[model samples]
Target: SGKVRAIVDDKGQQLKEAGPSMPVEVLGLGGVPSAGDNLTVVENEQRAREVAKYRQELATEKRTALAPTNFDTMFNTLSSNVIEFPVVVKADVQGSVEAIVNALHNLSNDDIKVRVLNGGVGAITESDVLLAGGSKAPIIGFNVRPNAKARELLKRDNVRMMYYDVIYHLTDAIAKEMIGELGPERIEHVVGRAQVKEVFKSGKRDKAAGLLVEEGVIRKGLFARLTRADVIVSATKIASLRRFKDDVDEVRAGLECGVVLEDTNDIKPGDQLEVFSVEERERTL
Candidate 1:
C-alpha cells in the first residue's frame, strides 16, 4: 500500500491548487522504506550464511577427527612378532633422555627397557660415543651438533645415530624399533644353571622341606632331582611353592622355596638337588 501527498510551496500552497501568481513545489507520492526497516531482512540473510559456514566447518572437523592418528601408523611400522631386546637410547642432552624415558614409560609392553647411556648437555664427544659403545646402544642427538670424529666413530662401529629437533620423531623412531619385525629364536641355552645346596625339614617327621633354589628358574611343571650324595631319593613336581610369601610358578637363583616331593621321603640335608627344564626348539635349516 502507498500513501499519496501533494507538493507544497514555501508559502504552504499545494502544487496542484496553487494559482499562477504563486510558486509551487512538486513531490513524489509513495512512502519510502527506512534503512532500519530493511535491516531485519539483511540480518536474516547474514545469519543464514553464518549457519551454512558453521555447518561446513563442523563437517571439516568431523573428517579430521575420524582420521587415523600418527601413532597407529607408527605401530604398524614398528610392531614385531618375536620377542626382542629392549632398545637402549643414548642421548646427548638430558632433556632428550627424559623425553625418551617418558616415551618408553608410556609404551604398552613392559618388556622394552629404554636405558639412557649418556645424558648430558654438551657436544657429542668420543667419551659419549664410547659409553654408547659399551652398551652397543643407539645414539640420538637432540639440538647438539655431532663432530666429524664422532660421526667417523659411529660409522666405524656401525652404530645408528638419529638426530631430531622434535621429540615426537624420536619417540616414533623408538616406537618403530619396538615394533620392527623379529626373527625366530635361532639359539637357545641355559644361561646359568646350578644344583640345590641343602634341603631342611620343618618337622621331625619331615613332611615339608625348605629347598634352596640353586639353579635356573625352578618352574612348576618341570623335573627336579632329590639327591642324597649321588643317590636319587625322589622326583617331584613342585606341588605348591612360595617365594617370600608370594606363590610363584618358578623361583630363580638366590631364592628359597618350600617344596613337597612326590612319592619320596628320603630327602636329607646336604643333598645336592638339580632342577632343569627341557627346552624345545625348531631349527630353520
Candidate 2:
C-alpha cells in the first residue's frame, strides 16, 4: 500500500483491499475534519497549484477590502473645532465591555463627542498600550489593568491610563472629562445702547457723561462699551447710573441720564455706548 502519511494522489497508487492487490483510482477522505479544516484531495500537481492560486486571490482581495482610509477623516477632524476624546476600552468581562461601550457611544453632539478607537474583553496588555499610543488615545480599562511591559511602555510613551474598579466610576470619570473638554460656549448679547450727550467732569479727572438712551434701557451696574463710529474706544463697567442728581436703577429710551463708566472717565460727546454682557452655555458630548 502506498504511504498515506503525506499528501499523495490516489490515482495510480497501489492498495490492498480484502487481501487482494489492486490499483486505487477512487478517492475517499478517510478522516473526519472540523469546520475550519481544509480537506484537499488533489488528483495531480496541476490541481494543487490551482487551489493555491485561488486561496491567494481570496487573501489579496480581503486585504484590499479591509484596509482603512483615514486621511479625509483626520483632515476634517483637524480643521474643525470639535472636542473628541479618542479612547480605547478594555474590560475583564464581555458583558461589562459591551455595556460600557454602549453607554459611551450614546453621548454625542455636534460640538463634542467620544470617539472609541478600539474595544475588547481581556486584561490590558502591551498591544493595547501600543494601539492607544499610535492613535493618540487614552486607555480606559474597567476591572483590568496593564501588565508590567504595558505599564513600562505607557510611561515611556506618556500615555494616560485610567483604570477603575467600579463601572460607575469609570463612566462618571469619562463623562466629567468630556464635559471639561467641551467647556462652555460664549454668547455675546447686546443689552442696550446710548449716545453721550455731554461730558461733565466730576471727581478729579473722572467724568460722568450725560446720555440719551437710544435703543434699550441702560441699567445700573450693566457692562458698558464706549464706541466711536462702530469702533470700540473703551470697555468698562457702569460705576454709577443716575438721573437728576438721584441714583436710579435704570433709564429708558428718549430719557436723559447720567452714566459713569467704572474706573474710566474717557467719555466724549457723540460716542456710542453699547451695553452688553457675555453669557456662557454648558455643552455636552
Candidate 3:
C-alpha cells in the first residue's frame, strides 16, 4: 500500500484516508485557495491577486466609512460670537496639539476663539490649570493625566477638564460646544447707503464719484447707494478716483478712493448712494 496522507479542503475540513496513488484530485473545496497557500503555483498567484484586490477594496471602504460626514461640522459648531466661554487645549504631545490646532483652524468660522492654555510634554499639572482658571476655558488634556494637586485645584476652582486619546472625539466635542453656545446664525449687515456728490465715467464698468461720506464709510467690496430724499434711487461706487487717477485705500469721512460700482441702474447726480456692507455675526449661545 502507498503512504497515507491527510488532506484539508479550503474550509480546513480534514479528508481522511487518502493515498497518493489513489487518483486524488484536489480542487478548491469552498471557493479558492489563498495566493499564499502552498498548492499549485498558478492557483497560488491567482489567489494572491484576488486577496490583494479584496484587501485594497476593504481598506478603501473602511476609509470612506470613517471619513467625516460634514466637512464644516467643526466650523459650524465652533464659530460663535459668545465670548463668555473659552475653550482651552492643553496637550503634552506635539502631534496631539497640532491636530487640535489644525482642526480649529480649518473650522468654518473664526469667531469662536480658542486659546491654547498650555502645551508641552509631561503630565497636566497645577500650572496648566492656573493658566486656564481666569479665562473660564475648558481644559483639554491628551495622553496626559492630572496629578493629585491638580485634580484638587480643578475641584476647588470648578474647572472642567476633558481628556482624550482620540483626536476625532476632541474635535467633535469642540464643535458641539460651539453649536450649543451659539444658536443658528444669519448674515445681516448688507447694503450700506452712501451719498454721491459727483459721478464721472472712466472706462467700461468703471466710474469715479466725488461724494460725501454719508451714513457709512465707503468700503471696498461693498455695494454703493444713491438716494433721493431719504429714498434710495441710484446705487453706485467710485470705481476709479483721482487727485486725477491715483488709487487710494478707502473713501473715509472727507477723502475718496477708486470705486468700481458695476451696475448703474439707480444713480443720479443729486441722489445719495448707500453702499451696503454685508457681515455675519454670531448671536446664539
Candidate 4:
C-alpha cells in the first residue's frame, strides 16, 4: 500500500538508492513495519501487492494461533469482573507505535487492563475512528493528527480523542484514566508485632495473652491478626492493652504486656500477633 517516495541519508541528503548496511530513512510506508522486519524491493507494483498480501496473511495466521476466538474465552470474559479499557493508537513511525503499545500494556494491573484494539503508523484515518467508536475506545494520536474524514467521523460518533507529542504525557493521562475507572485502592500497613509468651484466664470466661513486643508498638483498638506456625489463625483487634496490672494505650517493642483480643480467645503461647491499620489511597499505574 505504500510506495517508496524517497530515501534520506544520515546527512539529510536525498539518495536514489541505498547500499547494504548504509544507514537511511525510508519514506512512504503504508504502515510502519515492526522492528527487524525485512524491506524488500519488488520489480513492479503488482508484485509488490502480491508480497504485501502474503505478509498480511501470515501475520493474521500468527495472531490467530496466539489467541483464537472461542466460546469459552467469550464466556470467561463476560463472567469476569476485570475492567477493560480499550484504546486505539496511531503514531508517526513504527518505533513510536511499538513503544507506546508496550508502555500501555505494562500499565495493566489486577483492577483494570489497557486493551489496544489497533495500533498503526501514519495519520489517523476514518477507519481508525470507526473502530474506536464501535469499541467505545478513545483514540491516542502521537505526533500525528487525524485526516479530514477521520475528524468528521470522530465528531459524528462523539468519540474521544487524545493527542500527545511526549510519551510521558500520554502514559500519565492514560494512567489517570485507569484510576478513574477503578477508583481508589485500600492498603494495609503493619504498625506493630508481638509474640504471645503465655496465656492466662481473663475475668471468668475470657482469655488474654502475655506478649513480648517484638517490632512496633501494639496499640489497643488496632486491627490485628494471630498467627501460629506461620499460618494466620484469626483476624481480630486489640481489645485491651495492659502493662503488668495497669491499663496502657500501647506497648512498645522490647516490653512485655497483656493483650486481650476482641472476639478471639484461641490464642496460645508462642503464637505471633500483628497489629496493622488500613487506609484508602489513590491508585496509580
Task: Please report the candidate that would top lDDT against the real structure.
Answer: 4
Task: Residues 113-209, candidate 4: write the lDDT tens digits.
Answer: 8888878889998878887898899999999999999999999999999999999899999999999999888789999999999999999988999
Off by over 4 Å in 2: 1-79, 93-99, 130-137, 155-158, 164-169, 184-191, 196-210, 224-236, 239-253, 258-272, 277-285
Clashing pairs in 4: none
Candidate 2: the clashing residue pairs are none
- Would you estimate the TM-scores of all the predictions? 0.32, 0.53, 0.37, 0.52
Residue by residue across 203-225, what tens digits does model 3's lDDT show?
Answer: 66555556666554666655555
The lDDT for every candidate, in the order shown, is 0.56, 0.76, 0.59, 0.90
Off by over 4 Å in 3: 1-85, 186-285
Show model 4 residue runs off by greater than 4 Å. Answer: 1-87, 93-117, 125-137, 146-159, 171-191, 197-216, 221-223, 244-247, 253-256, 260-266, 276-285
Is candidate 2 or 3 superior in lDDT?
A: 2
RMSD (Å) of each candidate, 1 decimal: 25.5, 11.7, 18.2, 8.0
Better of 2 and 4 by lDDT: 4
lDDT of 3: 0.59
Tell me the TM-score of model 1.
0.32
